[model samples]
Target: MIEILELTELPRAKAAGALVADILQTMRSRAAVGTNLLDIDEWTKAMIVEAGAESCYVDYAPSFGRGPFGHYICTSVNDAVLHGRPHDYTLADGDLLSLDLAVSLGGLVADSAISFVVGDARPAESLAMIDATERALSAGIAAAGPGARIGDISHAIGSVLGEAGYPINTEFGGHGVGSTMHQDPHVSNKGRPGRGYKLRPGLLLALEPWVMADTAELVTDTDGWTLKSATGCRTAHSEHTIAITEDGAEILTLPNHS
Candidate 1:
């Protein structure tokens, strides 16, 4: 459903966004070379409960995924890109890790994701992929504002990734977030400008730009959740929840801590 939040509800949205940002930053610090994926999940759960917030992912059961995600956060590693279900694997040096999180606080929801290398070993290809997604995310946010078309944001994002030489995958990109995790206005990674839904004040959109190393195709893991590159190449994803405002698009999921 398309939800246009009232100004009165914006404070709650900001609080939710702050909580998501804090949690993601904390998780990034804790994810090390030997850390277990399940351990990260536990850490996320503890923080969510401590903050008196709810996890949007724990009960998320979309048609494309297995019912009830049953996890507090998504831990995608190396080749895994989206809907990465935490498993019994330990992270290794140079592994590209992506953490995607969504949380509800004060009756509002915000979502975000970040990709980084695990330990002391930073692979050039992995770092490049992460940089491309991050740059694309910034471009998308820059194109967002009241009266702007969703296609404008999509086109901006696609340009960055395309110039970086990564294939755009439209199967999943960004979406609206509000009282619930996912909402209307599916934002593609690539599209024509001046088309699709027009942006308006009070609208919250999670603009994510993700790409596989060399292909646009994705394959689901046997676990029925984790989506990885069809070619088994590395991947990266970056995202932020933004609010369309009179001045411009305000990023809600920026880390509050230094």
Candidate 2:
């Protein structure tokens, strides 16, 4: 389901993107030691309702998931990475927390995520992992623009993480996003350029670059969704929904308040 937004609907897409970005950033700022993961979900629900938006997660019951997610956002702790289901867990000092959010507004949708550590203590290893992911994300974005192939973007991201000595996982990566949350054209974190789909105007993609500290293998948690590092090492994820235009790839999910 590759969706290209009409020019008229682009403004709405931007609005939806802005709303999700603002919410994610706000939640990240408020997240700290002792903050409950469930509480964050509750807060996310309230914000979606107030904005007249719909949460893409609540009813998401894909084969990969246990069932209806029943949460407004994904709260991934130090070990949890993708599909992190919000549960009863308290954040601790220096705990690395990742918040992934997606929402639909005005018939359009946007998705994004951010990872950060709580409290004042910054573990060197955790910081390095987080930095690598962030750098990879930036590289991916740099490779995106008009007429750029998806592989080009993947190559850019993989280069950064590979150089940093982290293994890449292809099971889950970025994708095209529009009216619905996930769309076609899987953007693997590691790939060669000059391959795959050709980029064009009006296409939207969520380019995320995530990595585990030491291994590429992942094991699902008891919750049946949260992907954790097989070696139990820490992980980090960074994502942003971007729209391609005549100018270049425009990032739509940048929160105004971030």
Candidate 3:
């Protein structure tokens, strides 16, 4: 289902987006070496409750995932890229951590993700992977606007990641968000420009570009949720929710402190 926010709903969308961004930033700051993954989930739950926001992930039962996510946030580590279920694991130095979150505030929803290195150890390959995703995300956002097509954004994102030498995976990419966490108008990471859905004002899209270091193939963890690289190499993911407006695409998930 595709949703176009009315002018009155934009404020609520902004609020939800800001809350999502703030919570992710807070989690990133609190995540450190030896921090348990469960602790991160707990922190996310507390913050969501404090904000009076509902988690889109908790109790989420999608076809691809096992029923009921049963978690407040997605904590993807190292080889893990998407749908990472929190487990009884402690983070260690040099671990690449990706956190994806979506929440509803005032009946509007926003989603975002960020990947960063934990602790003081930043491996070169991991840093490069993270950088490529971030750059690709930026390119995608730049390609979005009131009249731009979804393919334009995809092409822009794919160009960066492909140039950086990471294979693109289309099985899971970005999507629309509004009254619910996931909506219609699937936005792939790579596509031909001038094709696909045409953008319109008030449309909200979550554009995420993720890549594994050496392979486009993914393997599901025994938990039945976490998606990891087939080669078990490091990976990174970056995402942001944006709203198409008359002027251009307005990024709603930028860090509040930034």
Q: Which one is best on lDDT? A: 1
lDDT of each: 0.95, 0.91, 0.94
lDDT ranking of the models: 1, 3, 2
What would the TM-score be for candidate 3 when compared with the true structure? 0.99
Poorly placed runs, candidate 1 (over 4 Å) = none
Enumerate residue pairs that collide in model 2. Answer: none
By TM-score, the better pick of 1 and 2 is: 1
Per residue, candidate 3 scores C-alpha lDDT tens digits across 1-258 of 789989888999999999999999999999999999999999999999999999999889989888899999999999999999999999999999999999999999999999999999869999999999999999999999988999999999999999999999999999999999889899999999999999999999999999999999999999989999999998999999999998889999999764
Per-residue lDDT of candidate 1, residues 28-146 (tens digit) = 99999999999999999999999999999888889999789999999999999998999999999999999999999998999999999999997999999999999999999999999
Candidate 2 lDDT over residue span 79-171, tens digit each: 888889989999999999989999999988899999999999889999898898888988888888888999999999999999999999999
Residue 19 of candidate 1: its Cα lDDT?
A: 93
Residue 29 displacement (Å), model 2: 1.5
Worst 10 residues of 2 by lDDT: 249-258
C-alpha root-mean-square deviation, each candidate? 0.7, 1.0, 0.8
